[model samples]
Target: MPDIIRLLPDNVSNQIAAGEVVQRPSSVVKELLENAIDANAKQIQLMVKEAGRNLIQVVDNGMGMSATDARMSFERHATSKIANTEDIFHIKTKGFRGEALASIAAVSQVELRTKKEEEEVGTQIIIEGGQLISQEVIHIPTGSSFQIKNLFYNVPARRKFLKSNSVEFRHVLDEFHRVALAHEDIQFQLYNNGEELLRLRSGNLLQRISDIFGRKIKNLLIPISEELEWVKLSGFVGKPESAKKTRGEQFLFVNHRFFKSTYFNKAVQDAFEGLIPQRYLPSFFLYIEIDIERIDVNIHPSKTEIKFEDESSIYALLRTAIKKSLGVYHVAPSLDFEQNQDWVFSIPKKDSPIEEPKIKINPAYNPFKENSKPFTKAEKLNVTEFYSSFRNDDITSDLFDAPSANNEENFLRLMNGRWMIEHKGQLWCIDPYRIHQTILYNKYIKSIKNHALSQQLLFPLERPVYDLEKEKLISIQSKLFAQGFDMQIEDDLLTITAIPSDILQEKVLDIIEELLYQLTEHSEEEFSVFFSKSVSKVSAKKRNEFIQSSQIRPIWEEFKNLEMPYLNPLNKKNYEIISIPNFE
Candidate 1:
């Protein structure tokens, strides 16, 4: 018991370090990619199988290692990037602690093949669970190739904590994007399970961004460049219109190394305060280049967090730089008196007298008249006839069938964006939006479970989306078809030959966009739940606008018959009751 504080074994220490460096397959991807960059690789290829559960491979045409160096690279604290304690302050390379390879090898089966450019042959080494299995000279190219198989194999608990393939792959894609973006001149290729996910050729930053995200991002980006005494900031900020509900596209890099800093992100958000909607985050790819001594990047094992000596100054500068760029690009409104010549319209001279506006009115029009044309049919119909007509018309009659014809006194009345009704001698104030969301949620869920009715469009609608979004849509194409969306992909454009009968033609693009956003934001959610929420969100917005119309009564009818009329799909209370006795 007194000697319990003894030093841990090398393998145990390496495995503990692995917890920080190799959190998941994506973490391994980030470390290997950075190592390749540090080696001055011009071309890097990343290959993964089963979202990196089975295998992860990285081949880079970099300055390969020597036979002796290759064997020592997997040892704890073995590094060439730093020599002394003072070297950490001036560090520029990505991996310096030397724990990356050691930590990675501790948790998985790692294979390494490396050869110096001047060498004729390479050295191949295989290690399993931090134990060297074999090392031999082999005839390979003058570069380095690393294969990590059975990741977290020795740590069953860690392996069990991994997410689904789609989610894990998304994280891997995020890491790949960060590395490929920071170094635009380096060619990068990524393949998932033998299918090519991305192939980014050597190009400029803008081109790299466009290739990774979609070509549409090119137009959405607004260039930002500024140089100050403490920090030099440069990169792109997306337009306010391009802001998204998710934070997947936001990136911040310090000296070509990707990092996450909520403080810096807040600066960007503050600059776009009124430009974007609340709860929405704008996309940004900002790179801050400061003196290596001014920032500390070794604070975290992943190196994604940096501590700046002058964070306040950097924040102010970053905010001003982005704000200036937005104004310069005309993305933010300007109050300059100088008008755009293209938008100028000549006003008619006062000499040419202005014509008086004409107005038309029906003097006999009385909205409250009982026998009026609009009110005659509505007033004459009883509850039974009114609901029967909805059923005959194939509307949501089944959802709203009345319990009894004598209970017609429980009528629906629209007031201030809510539905006021009398039920069980109590006044109920219902949020029509939430109630409609519940109705559509169940309806769409049922439609998705069965085959939804598709309304063929007279003219097909073509919408242009990003390449990644196109892939996402393709992955869920069968589910979309089941939900009454007949979509066809041609190039980057998605054509809609048909849509759900209840969806408006004008809102198809908006609906699809929201659907894809929800899907991307919640990839781990069950498909049925995701689809229902997406449909409900889109349909809710439209229903909110529709609740003001004269046709709201039928919608309220359906709301009343819901199995859970008091709560929405999100579990939010939809209505509150005002007891008649309490009111009296």
Candidate 2:
């Protein structure tokens, strides 16, 4: 029998690797920007066309590569960061695995031009489908420039899955922001299809934050700094009052590399407990510094997820650090001042007599008690016998089996906005109030249980996924896979033929997409867990808003009324039938 396995072609290998590194336009942006940052680039210019669907060019004033290095850079597993196993733990620089360039080149037509500062001549190299097409020595500035065109072109399956231009562009913008925020001292400029997006000059962290997120963030950030035995925490947390309903602003970094940590985020959230509203999530940009051996960065190919040797110790330290900062200053701003200005309470005038009050509420009764039953079988029999009275009348033949009259006088609105049939011989009424509540409750409960189905197109359905996301996708891929998802992966493109369990719902997809962006940009934290908590927070908030008192009428009181018949709908006119004649 022939061997079942054989070595794959170079292009296939590159495409598979690209699946690990370049999930979307944002993935390419992250890899290239990291390369620039690692090169110690002082100034970088980024230009994108069609939200990075068509072109992504990065020009950096950093140490350029030689003719030989430029050509070899497109090979898989190629790296200048590590040569031996021991060096993995004691790592400092970013972009270590060297799969980023090779993966990116696999999916796109790439062009590179560079010259070292000391070298008078530069080198130019071009590649398509992981195949080198040209290499030549040329004269250029003492920097490197890379232009990636027709991303995922070789993989039509991936290209076919791309999202709308606006959506893909937003992903590109997100990547640009993260890289720019991490290295605030580096000059970075972003342009979309020749239109200038952001030009960030070297500045302080706060300055960078303000430029990217807007000046509103300036007032919310409070400096946080603490040094423990080995680990150091330094950054800013948004004031509790400024917390947002959305999770777009939270960021956590480790030694300048962006990361997400649920444990650490909980520490931050715990510190803000009681300071912010229950449903609100506080924003922060925190970074921790620890010794290299203390944490492992080489766990994944992308090196975004790190495992700590002593997690509990780190958690305790982070909690204490955040709480200590909160103790020193008021984090929740005083909104009472504004409320006071806009709203003034006036004391009721003593001379004004109160209008006639509502009739005294009936005493409550328990359903378990034998006599407290709202309806008895006898009442239903009586109603049926009464119908016979109308059946004998030839002149009122239409009245015998006619639909129950919906008259307002005979019906009373239940606290839940439902109408009870109020029939007191010769009178009929309906209550619309109760009708609304019943409809709403049924709808809400059904929605929560997944009875409702909604479909949304996966934007950029054929988009590439980065290494950071490859693990995430793989982790959740099973859940999606079980739901009839047709997951096909090629160089840079991941096409989802089916969406799993309605993850494509507008709300669900938005959060998932945000989580993907967060995971890609910040590689240090456990975002999935953090996001699960966020999902809980958001779900709880939605439930509260959906079922709040304003959304429905009070039902508990009406549910327990004295002297009610089992078959008669509870209403004002049923007093005689239940022996509560003084109900008026």
Candidate 3:
């Protein structure tokens, strides 16, 4: 037997810490930007090359470090944020854990240049893989510039596992946006591969939001604010009409730190229960200011998830604030039992001749004239012949089970926007929207893989956008084209002349907006799913627009081909079946 356990070397220890702190290139961006914010920088500049794989540089006009402090900054567990254990509870700065710099340096090539405001000269310290290459006094400005290059160079496995440049760039862009939005008073500029991608001027939170989103969204915002003995909540909630089918526009912060909490998000969603359409999430930029001792920001490595001492009270007050804002802005209906009834019942009298309600109908219309080949139920449902008329080979062969020789196949559109299908001897209720989404999702994944063709529009549509949005849209133009959207950036506008053939032309503009928002706010994998769902709703027939059973035929026809016809794209049951109870 031998004693095998030994203390890991400092380099090995830091490399292990890097695994937690520096998950990807964007993680580096988050650390550097937050460090700049903590430095009291009025203007922060970030530049990245090849989506941060080649280089990531952050320069800030903040109070810089001295020659001795510059060298100590790279040492693991050396930090200025905390002195005693009590300081941990009252954490105010972004970079509290001193492991960030050391961890980042262990896996990458880092060069730090810093000079204090009163110092006549600066210090340039270059370190590679936790080993100091050089440290010398140099003439520099009164700030700090951290240049991290060849990220994960010492860790070849992690470098190889990085996503494509486009995808990685998106992650970096998201970090930049989050930091910029969290601190609206500090100007931030982002550059990618030498081109200025984003410039956020210092302003109020609402101004920053409007600038980033590239729209006059002020009209869509309703201010909300409330203060209790323990917590204060204030921010802007988008009007119900401004709610979207996607979930990108929501931003929540605690003491100017961006974090994600579905628990708190549900409070906002519950406030708009009946105001917005089902399955649609409202947009909100909420800020919570509470005692630092009552909340723990160290629950996660990235500090994006926090624990509140009394979340229930916070939730109750937050939901109330949002509901009050909505009602005050008249975005939600208000009931006043004290109002007089005479004005409500009286309509302005018209002097013109009274006109009878006209019945609009098509006299020559017939419901049985479907373009697909039809066979009665007696033929045992010739699925081979039926799918052939669809001209799609992707459809699976899971149409239905063997039908009884009792009833004919029938589709009846129910008043509540569901479908009633009488097949064989059973009746099934179907959610057409979910079925539609499943079909569209399948089709879209295939299209993306196959590089489907686009359908050109008769009229080119131009949407006004800010310069920042144009740059972002142009960057992801190739990805959009792969999904069959031909988008171009003209002066101050995003122009589209074509879209996916399966998409509805009437909603081309809205679909484009959702696509851009989702791509900007989510990862590539999530954007695909969200894009499909958003388009499915806008393209599918509205619940109130059903004229006959024929409109539902397309959804039914596509749903029958699903590998699991019982479930929708989200894996939820789209239909319910009930057997008849015999009365003997």
lDDT of each: 0.84, 0.67, 0.82
Top lDDT prediction, candidate number: 1
Deviation of model 1 at 375, angstroms: 39
- Per residue, candidate 1 scores C-alpha lDDT tens digits across 241-299 of 88876556788999999999999999999999899988789989999999999999889
Deviation (Å) of 391 in candidate 3: 40
Q: What is the lDDT of residue 485 in candidate 2?
A: 48
Q: Which ranking of candidates, highest TM-score first?
A: 1, 3, 2
Candidate 3 shows a clash count of 0
Candidate 1 stretches greater than 4 Å from native: 1-6, 335-422, 425-427, 520-526, 541-553, 578-584
TM-scores for all predictions: 0.81, 0.61, 0.75
For residues 1-584, what per-residue lDDT tens digits would candidate 2 score against the true structure?
97899899988988998887888888888888888888889999999998788899999999988877777788888887788888887888887887999999999999999989888899999999888899998999988999999999989999888776655766776677767778899999988778776778899998888777665567777888888789998888887766754465778778788766788778778878788876568878887889988988877765667788898887887766666666555444443422435457877799987777689765785666686567789999999888777745544333123343553223333454333333444322222333223333333334434533434455535543432344456555654443334566553346655443424333454444444544442344443344433233222222223232323223322422322232222122322233335566
- Please give the range of 10 consecutive residues that has the lowest summed lDDT in model 1: 393-402
Instruction: Determine which window of 10 residues in candidate 2 has minimal summed lDDT.
Output: 566-575
The model with the greatest TM-score is 1
